[model samples]
Target chain A: MQAWDISFSKLKAGYGSHVVLTDVTAALPAGAVSVILGGSGCGKSTLLRQIIGLSKPLSGEVRVAGRDICTLPPAEFRRVRRRMGVLFQDGALLGALTLAQNVALPLTEHLNLPAEAVRAEAVRILGMVGLSDFADFYPNELSGGMRKRAGLARAIIAQPRILLCDEPTSGLDPITAARMDDLLLSMHRRFPEMTIVSVSHDLASLNRIADYVLVLRDGACVFAGTQDALRASDDPYLVRFLNRDGAGDDAAAGECAAPAVQASLDRWFAS
Target chain B: MPQRNADDISRASPPVKVLRLLGRPALRALNAMGSVTLFMLDGLRHIFTTRRILGRTVRQIYVIGYQSLFVILLIGLFCGMVLGLQGYYTLVRFGSVGMLGSAVSLTMIRELGPVLTAIMLTGRAGSSMTAEIGVMRITDQIDALDVMDINSVAYLVSPRIVAALLSFPMLTAIFDVTGIFGGYLTGVCMLDINEGAYLYRIVSSVTMTDVAGGFLKALVFGLLVTTVCCHQGYKAHLRRDSVGPEAVGSATTSAVVISCVLILAADYVLTSILL
Candidate 1:
């Protein structure tokens, strides 16, 4: 029933010298759906990774519930992680385990509940996701949309106070994406105090579920505020982003292909 | 004239540049070795701390040891039969065909059994371990485990290590027995050597020390192979040579090659120490 606010202070992160996120300072309020929006390579996932403790930031702090997890000892960090859950871009279900077993993993690992109880809880969550009929199936056997739903079921089944979803509806159809957003809204209502952070570029999903919004561009947080403030802002880039316009962007400044490469393509098409 | 970069300007001479080039790879190799050692130590630590490790270990043994039985037996039998035929002919030339049984049994128990069985297993189970974990790493399942506060090493690698430790010696024993039988079929049934003399030579010449030495080699090979495979898979994402599924493929290949080479290298070092 408890939720934690995530705060970032000048966070810098990347692999080796390839910095993906720089000076990303923001507060994702507790008990709110905070959507992180950016272009394909603007460090949304990197920022999420920092919050999840998957990879430590190069410099600065990521505080969950006022404790800077960036410097937490391994044991302490693990305990912090116990209160959090994540839905990866893909389901990331263990291929060796069935859907029921995958959903039950957290309970089995962290709780001393009987096997039947765990199974029952897993099935109940699967039913919540409308996948009760497919509880015995493997992740690979499910469609992409179904997998995402299953992943959500697994992520929320443990009643984590903080849930992070990475690109939750990136590859789904519009209908499925809408359904996912509704499911997320229902989850928020179910646990009113749970902090949910999602990395997404879906403007529709953002409009549907986001109470708070953080927008990144060129490895920097350009906007962090409520959805209404985000929409009302007159920033040219944000306006263009909201309108789905591509004018004056880098791609618009260049030829689609090199002249030589275009000529080669012309020759191929001539064939 | 070509423009010199800052790095080029900093380098003093051709000889120094060559030394630097050589040193870079040497340093990298050392770094890799250190990483593998630490990874193995971490997995071993988790093996002690993880609850219900026996259940996981048993499952891994079924996969790594039981599933690998037929191939090991087939290879072991042929190796012993070949040794039997070779030893008989060589001893016959020396007018000491009676020593054929000692030759076959000793060669098998001391050297071929553990080494060959490990090499076979490296190809079979070790490669599978690398691929399985590599796929999991790329697909984010490992990250999923981490997010759930599950120790990924304990959940994945430690059980395989424990399984390898128990199964290697057992499989080696099976290899030795099957191989000795194969030798009997060759030396006695096919080559018409006296069965009693062959049996007596094996019983008389083979010592408990030899058997223990063979088992020691097997255990060492098992540890090395499993550690190498697990390390490769665990670090597949960090490899400079590839990415995604290609990285997994590269890791699997490296696991098998590295495990086989380490088996031979460690066999030499262990044989010397045990001797």
Candidate 2:
């Protein structure tokens, strides 16, 4: 199935008028894990939001599963969304619910599973994510890694075909980040047809997990190709970003300036 | 090659700049009005899903509404005593203790019960709703729900509005009953008013219209508190400003203020029309 071929053409998204994404055009191959590599304010999350249909694009088309999701009617849009899963940064677990309850939410809301069946499924997913022992715990009771594990369990509960993760490794220690990478890769390996896209500024995590990569800078796609191609290119941006060096030529130093901002207006307005 | 041409850039007046800064969000909010109305309409549509939503709503009423009954009763009794004490003194001076029972029952049932109970909810439930949804916004749970193809407003706001509409009137009824009983207790136990006559006057004087008006006001008040709180919470900035916890505090405070304004305004209009 060509269900995983996702493309965005000149997509623009903003919170109100302060546009976070400006004319971003990119594509990711079917059933491949694509990491959106970027600095803060580079519209990585905004791109994810547009693809997920949370925020409407100002101008452009996002073709996911070969349909224009932005213009789809409500019922159609919901059908599109049902095929997706999202692991929000900060682990987005409901504080009011237990970890099992959080994981069971999608099953309860979208599936025909009986309550007992949902409970059993929730336990299975939590066990898959290494959070089985923590099922009865509330979000406040779990550690950061455990919360992320519970969040992962929730995202995959409905076994969506497309998974979008935002900053999955942030606020995590290196060991935990590596563990999360293993978990993500294992998930991909288990369902080879799953299209997984993750947003990350962490080069190490991206390098560890991303098969196909798109480097976004200032709300536009700078590069979209394989991780090996990105590494081999003489693009100083890829170098500095990968090198984690603060000292570099201005353009390549992972700087984030909102798109279409002129030099004069940029300095003048920030004053 | 060029000196900074600060003079080249013209600035709008301060108020104009502030207005411009606010304009986008204001327009966005205006655009979202359709969504809000649709959400409210969806709550009304729950007349079909009553088996599900009402069961959920009634369960919520048990947890959120009736669980607070003790405090409501306490406030009602105290409110009645104060009204009674004031009415007794005022009526005694006019030698119109006969009118005291009528006055207390009518005001308590038609006005104070709904108003006071709503004010209490503004403190109790309104602030809580703001906190709950605000935390959800900051934590990105709201976004997760959106990505899951659920209308966050319908999922979050509709249930709340339904619960409030159902629960607030029930609470007001209890408040009205306890408040009148409190007045009776004061009149019969503490004062020299004939117990049977006082009870009779309270029962006879309060028209069905008065009680119905109070319940109607309760419904409106409930909608106001839930809608305003949910709105404020929905708009809670993901980034809490350097002004500290001011945003959450302000959301809660705004819920209370907006609820109070809507209730009083609705009270005036409803009383004018219905009474």
Best-fitting candidate, scored by TM-score:
1
Write candidate 1's Cα lDDT for A143-169 as tens digits. 999999999999998888899999999
Measured against the true two-chain complex, the DockQ scores of the candidates, in the order shown, are 0.84, 0.50
Cα-based lDDT for every prediction: 0.93, 0.82
Query: Can you list the residue pairs that collide in candidate 1?
Result: none
Candidate 1's TM-score reads 0.96
Q: Give the Å error, residue A20, model 2.
A: 2.4
The estimated TM-scores of all candidates read: 0.96, 0.87
Residues B151-248, candidate 2: write the lDDT tens digits.
67766777788788888999999998888888877776788777777778887888888888899899988887787788878777743342225676
Model 2: per-residue Cα lDDT over A1-271, one tens digit each: 4447789998888887678778878898888889998998899988988888878888889998889998889889888889899998878988878999889987677667678999998999999999888888899998788788788888888878898898888999999989998999999999889999999998888878898999988888889999889988788877888888667366666676556666767888899
Q: Quote the positional error of residue B159 for candidate 1 in Å.
A: 0.3
Model 2 chain B lowest lDDT segment of ten: B1-10
